[model samples]
Target: MASRARGLNEDGGFVKWDWNKNKYIWVSKDEINKPSKPGHSKYAWKDGNKVAARRPSFKVPVKKACRQPLQVANKHGKMKTPSPKKPSRRPVHHKADFIVPGYDHGYDDGYDEVDEKENYPRNEKYNAREGKIPPPPELHSGHTTILSVMSNRLIHVNAALTFWRQGPNEYISYVIRTEDDAATVDTLPALVNCFKNKTPVSKQLSLGACFELLPTLKKLLSSKFEDYVKTSLDTLRTMLRFWWNDLIAHRNQSFSGDLQQSRSVAGIYMSAIAMTDIITKLCKRKDGIAKKAEIVGTLLAQL
Candidate 1:
């Protein structure tokens, strides 16, 4: 006989062959321990084996389809994960507190972002307050102020040439000949003496005299006495250089003064500019004198 498990079958019960009655018999868990014939055998166990007859197979009922859309099975689905935003690479610039009020800091639209109403008081009472009115026309007149502070130190050609050597006999004899002759004879020597003194006031006066006489000298001797003309031009050029340097030094020194004094300083600059303008015009002439006065004229013009 074949060995088997000593328990009830998985399908609930088993069938065994009865040797005494020469037939098969059904056994349940309660009768599993009953004695059997020595050579009798139990039916082989099978997954479908059962003590009772098997029931008919049944068919399942189908249901209606859903109206909703089908979803994806994966948790990630069709949507993509967005990458994290990158940090800005540009540096932020903040306005400085110590900067001047009207100074441009290259902000938006080239202006400061200030609230005018907050910083400046504005109201009918503030507008109507006493002492808020503008000054009278007499006190604030532009033309009057300008004329009042205008310099009286006018640089006339006659006044400048007063430093030239003039004697009583020469003045009396001037009616007999041309003023050009006097200029030719005395201008160079006077210039030599003026610089030889090495005084600041005298040097300034000498520069004025030289500037006044330059055109006359150039016109008179530029064609006849080339050597004398060259010497005179060279001397004038040297004087111009020294005078220009002095002018620059004086200009560079700041002067804090009243309106009249300031206007006087401005007048000096104006005179210098006018003198340089004359030299510039002379340098533009077609004559060879232009070549001689080029360097000095250019220097003064730049200043």
Candidate 2:
């Protein structure tokens, strides 16, 4: 006798198998008398030495497509995970307060107040009261002013010389000559004395005397003397030298004093000397003697 195999079903029921028939049998202890359904038959099986008459096959029924068991997923309840936080925004800064008014777009509330003071007027009262506008102290003619006085002196000398040349018998002529000679002679001495004594002849006297005497001497000597007219030329040269020295002294003083007149005086002195030299040369010839006085007189007038 062969032993039979047995297994438990899903419901914890026992399933028995017969080796000879190769079939499974189900036995219900609670209801053993239930009839098998159609297409299934009862069967006899021997186990050990005992025989069982009626037994049902243990095959389960084929399930319909709609009746099949559904697959159920076991899902854990949803966990609450926190969302990541966003980073904070930085605060915006405004520009500083000390910015200039026109440039700044923000508030100007805290600035200091500025005080604007009006300017005072300048004091012109003293200037106005003094009438500080006298005719620019007459700008004395540099050459003319000096020459005028010299001219007057020479006139006086010439008158006296004229008088000395004419005799008393020719009373009218004498008077005229005496008057001219006195005038001309008088000027030369006065000028010489002024220079010798270091006394300054007024600019008028200095220039005038030179101008008047130069032509007169030239004229008088031209008739009798050639280029080397010693007596008259000596006198004229002496006078000119003295005048030149005086002018140089005046120029030095002016320079020390920082005066503008010194420049003019110096220029005049140079011009006069040049003119004198020209005249002397011009009248040096024998033919030139006749016109020497007239030419010299014309030159003086021009000066």
Candidate 3:
């Protein structure tokens, strides 16, 4: 007769946690032997069959064996089969900006059954929606984006200081990683505008606002800067060709990726052209990115 009882000096069978007692309690009345080796169980399935002198368990029939079954049985209770609900699909609206990712999956746990619903996307134009540039970091939004809009044109600058000054140690690195903007002569008017009233606003940007955009650029370029520059220069040639073709496109959407994804690949090329042109003028300045590029190139060669 199997009976549940508290784990006294002799634990009958497998012990279960008793939350009320705050100690392990034996749940069965079977006579079980404890392991001799410290923290090791002799009845453990791995060496459960091994006897006092390496005697096999199969040689001695289970009917005449010492160890009894650990499993507890309830005659009244029956195992249940989970009946999964059929998932219904909604018609795809062509005007929707996003794609539906996946389907719904909900399973049963006894009487408790949950019906989890799926998510919806914005529209059918996937890249057009994805390619849309996000808002500023310092706004009421949840992001700690380093890039903040400067002037009417989009300019990426270090906005980490903006958030940190507002509160404690709060800065976002993703906004900085995606930044490609470097200071140039064309930005002089913007920088000067920022210093209006002899005191620059926290929202405005200057040469000081532009630090190492990508931290990895410094570490990785210490050894691979020259190679990266060389490869970038080669890639720049191809980008220029694509940019020219895109510029000469009769229809503005001709250079778009696909029917669904209307993302233009020429935007970065145009930004690169603007920066390269600015760096050409920055060559005259003592403190310019062109010199930094050369320094990095030289350091890469030395390393």
What TM-score does each of the candidates earn?
0.27, 0.23, 0.17
Query: What lDDT would each prediction earn against the true structure?
Result: 0.47, 0.44, 0.35
Q: In candidate 1, which residue pairs clash? A: none
The digit string of per-residue lDDT tens for model 2 on 116-143 reads 1112122332222233322333665476
Model 3 TM-score, 2 decimals: 0.17
- Models sorted by TM-score, best on top: 1, 2, 3
Please report the candidate that would top TM-score against the real structure: 1
Residue-wise C-alpha lDDT for candidate 3, range 34-110, written one tens digit per residue:
33463323333555444432322223233565633322122223456698987767634332332233623232333
**Residue 23 of model 1: what lDDT?**
89
Clash count, candidate 2? 38
Worst 10 residues of 1 by lDDT: 52-61
Q: Give the winner by TM-score: 2 or 3.
A: 2
User: lDDT tens string, model 1, 1-303?
Assistant: 798766545656679877557789987866776764433122311233442112221221226642221232233356778999999985332344324445555766765434321344444223323214334567756886566434322222243355333532232133123444334443355454545555554533533444444445445334455456555556555555556655565455534332332443444445545555545655776778778767656765666
Which ranges in model 3 have alpha carbons more than 4 Å from their true place?
Answer: 1-224, 250-266, 278-303
